[model samples]
Target chain A: MQATESVIYNRAGQRVVSPEYLLFEAPRTKHFMTGSEAVKEAVRRASVDASVSYPITPQSEAAHLIGELWVEGYVGVYFRGESEFGVMSEIAGCAMAGARTITTTSGPGTLRAFENFPMWAGTRIPVQLVLMARGVNSPLSIQPDNLEVGFLLDTGCMIWYAENAQDLFDMILAGFVVAEQPDVHVPVITVVDGFFVSHTREAIMLPPDDIALPPYNPYRAPMPVIDAEVPPGRFLRDPFVMKSNYISYATHASWQWEVRSAIERSRPYAKRYLKGLIEEFGDPSAELVFVACGTAAAQAKEAVRLLEDEGIKARVVKLKTIRPFPVEELKGAVKNAKYIFVPEFNVVGWLEREVRRYLYGHSDAEVIGSPRVAGGMTMPAEVIVQEVLKLTGKEVKHVL
Target chain B: MMRKRVNIRMPALGGQGAVTAAHIIATAADYEGYYAVSNPFFGAEKRMAPAESYARIGLEPIFDRGEVVYPDVIMVFHPQVITMGKSYTMPFYSGIKRKGLIIINTEEDLLTDEDKERLESLDVKVLNFPATKLAIDIAGTELSTNMAMIGALFGAIGCVGLDAIEEGIKSRFLKKFVASGGTASLDSALERKFKKKLELIEKNLNTAKGAYDLAQRWAGEQGLEPFLPPPPKKVTV
Candidate 1:
């Protein structure tokens, strides 16, 4: 494949296909690598227009790899930003100028760039932020602690938690497809636990590099493109100016609702592209269940297996999307469950609260948050087993 | 009876290539058609600091991640991990399973009498050898110490063949591999020492082969059974 002035073709000379064909129909070969490498491979086929990066642990290597892609001609524009705040604004500018934009950040960086997220949603720019979650500062830790994700829950960006390296690869590609939809033109935040997913090596199947998802079409956006090819929206030309009138107040209120509604509108697309908003595994008829996401869900899967070995029935309801929370699908999955355990890597039990709030009157199952490992502690499968046995009044076996 | 899953914990000082060893072991297991996962300890890793990594190999899909709290095998890549108590766990052999194996890279036995008695109670066997010495003797550099450790791991397990190990080593060195910042630097240092890429791989392979022969002979004499069942039919890729 040759590179034209504007369009870039992969080395195999294959034309870009639809997202569905690229994700499902295309044959994939297995590769053993880390999630950072997975990010590079995914962006290699994403047809990304521009990327701005800042330095942070567990995410800097991936950001550097993307810069390498830029040098390799897979990405159109790339540069290092002054800071996370500046980087977020720079990517927002890229998106506003009708360029497909992506960036990454970790714990403190996420908070430092916090203001741009809501603005990204309000302006309806479909930029994707791959948030490698880590511990917030004040004690200063660079390990994988997802307490930062709790702060982004209300940021209006569509949130999706990836379980492992394979999930990270697929979700990133699928995230762009879902976020760029006309009805769902909101920013997407693909969250993965730092270090655990970013540094761990595992096997993942990837589609051929020759094939890629079709390029971003700014014309399909619900809002007008801000580039020279098209005139910008009249009201959007200058959005910061405010008039203290009832119309302004009402417009502000309704637009916030609409931004959230756009996230809700992404359900069908996310469900279809991600295969499901929630993945189920283990005994289908089990009464004991685990509701988790990210590495917690991976640990829960292993716990399910260990629980099964002891003749106890259990299952895992792994949540793929946090925003536009799959309430109905979750309700359907936990209908038969009597004891629901939520395993998490943070002290806040944010997922447990979400499960409880959503299931307040829908189900009678007792929601219990167990084995919360904070400050980047490892929540091994054995810890989950002990939690399960202790909660269920079963004798804890020395299985290890 | 053959075990279905084997979790190996490696504790060593930073820059000792424990993380690389973990990656190669899992990659070799994957080549032999087993599900495997490997990861380093989540911390600020520095040179000479207590660094650890874990690998899980099983017939079924392995989902557990992070540090291996419980291990069927423990490979101590440095004498300091035992003598200086430069380890995350207090006893260094804290969670070894019954009849598990511990391979220590030291010329002398570092276990105290009480420690040996505790290990004996758990029926765990300790294999001590100067792995760094073997690396210097065969590879002419101590940087290949990880290669020797990997060899001993597969030697005692008696499952992954030498050809698969070779494939794992080739994929790691010949391809654009990224384990961490320190490991990448160490890799370049090895390349500079060998002067050629193929020669570097050849030296590392020779170091591993030397350690493999010694460990295999010792394992056979000790009647150590296969740590894992024969991996599902090898998929030639």
Candidate 2:
């Protein structure tokens, strides 16, 4: 199919012909911080108006740190509530009131927060949530796991998985834009590895606030404003009006298709942003590129470094934007690589499976899965490196 | 720039205020204008399965936020934790820096000759202070071990003075103790403990002429720097 040109008219009322250009300058780099700190910084950079959060392990620090930012008057409204339900409800109310709202939580909290997900999606509220993957049900441990993301897969919200601290920082920043985009008003949940990325600290190049984020777009609720002088009209009671609104239902479904298309359309832009990051630092191209998100990605980078020192070509493509999954860019980046290691802090059942599916028809690269059970324990870098070597038919020297 | 970073891990079961002791040390350091961060490594372990809390103090920013795999100081609030030997002590001992200090809250005679030999071989400066005894003598209850440890930390670091320690204790523990219905008694106990430690230091000065003179003299004789102990060797089976 031939790509048709979308015409553009200049201010002089004359047609102007120009090919599409997707380009962005490199963002500045700063010192490292945790995923939670990154999320809080993103919220601050995005000028998020309101945030509500409840305490949950692994994810609690994000909420606490954001609350600290709120107390310091760096962010907007902050509410510390009794439960995750209350936090989600507050986010929904804030979003409906035309505020850029956010809330963070973990596995069970994400599950409880999921009740608000459908409503928020239905109302087309642009709320951002940082969901830390943790275990639920099995043996009951409070360590890093991805069971929560599995439960959230069916939800209409876009999911972004961060492989390490740096990706966590970038993904949170990107999520603000993706969630607030008018064409894609679905809430975005950026999941990071609990305990591993949530609590662990590593060197992260945080983009400067002024350098990275675009202009803020405040949420607009569907409810129309009423005036005293104007005669009151029935809002939801008329069948004809409901039928006309059913057109909105079609619009909503089409909006979902548009989101998918925009995601594909945004590929070149995403690539430009990533290239900008690389230009500021350097390209992280290794022989075997480990694709991961959150803290696991951080470990993968360290592992790659260790492997490279041991005469192995290993690099890590840490996914900073999970939702609006940068599938095309990832495929393009790793298509030439021999092996793509995807390590998730959560269970292997969902995201890894999805990644494998995404890569199935696109690349011939062998996507190896290293699924760490939820709440098990932090998977050391040495273990990840050894796994990569094993997958590449290299002798493993270390075992954890 | 490299700065001295010390992680103090307390060995006490739940409800023993071991975590509070670590917090007090961290808060005391902060009060002294040193950067400090404290976090508890709490798990499913209940009252007796050996709970540990970590406190990190540094002049520079701290990066590694995991469990204190290598600690400059390991402060044990319970003597039984040491008696348990390899099982309870190995995890703590494994992380001790080469020139680390290990302060055990017990009577001096609690360590066996073999235990002393083992620690000496590892080059660990083991100080067996009767913190519980000191607590009972001053506070009339062994539960004031956290306060006693704070006093000991003040004695060891010397950077944090009694005033800062008192303020830290007041800010962190006073309200909590009062809320738990032991307000007056806990305050009096804390004051008495502080007074006793002050009296000991005053007496030490009168006898020895300079503060920490005896400690310095002993450490100098052993070719060790004052307040800076020798690093412990990595334990091998």
Interface RMSD per candidate: 2.5, 10.9
Native RMSD of candidate 2 (Å): 11.0
Candidate 1 lDDT by residue in tens digits, A1-400: 2234555454324467778877888888888888888999988888888999999987987898998888777888899999999999999999988888888899999999999989899889999999999998879998889998998998889999999999999999999999999999999999999988888999898998877878888888877878867764354632444665556766778888999999999999999999999999899999999999999999999888888877899999999999989999999999999999999989899999999999999998989998799998988888899889999999877466
Model 2 lDDT at residue A358:
75
Show model 2 residue runs off by greater than 4 Å.
A1-46, A61-82, A161-174, A197-255, A259-286, A308-311, A386-393, A396-400, B1-50, B53-237
* Leading candidate by DockQ: 1
Ten contiguous residues with the weakest lDDT in model 1 chain A: A1-10
DockQ of each: 0.59, 0.06
Stretch of 10 with least lDDT, candidate 2 chain B: B228-237
lDDT of 2 by residue, B1-237 (tens): 122556676667666677676666666566655555555553544666677766767654443333565566777777667666522346446656556677777775566677567667767787666766766666556667666766665565445655556555554533311212443456688789668766644432232122123334444555654332222231111
What would the TM-scores of all predictions be?
A: 0.95, 0.63
**Which ranges of candidate 1 are over 4 A from the true structure?**
A1-14, A232-238, A244-246, B176-195, B234-236
For candidate 2, lDDT tens digit of each residue in A222-274?
33212222233544311132445347666667755654554444444444434
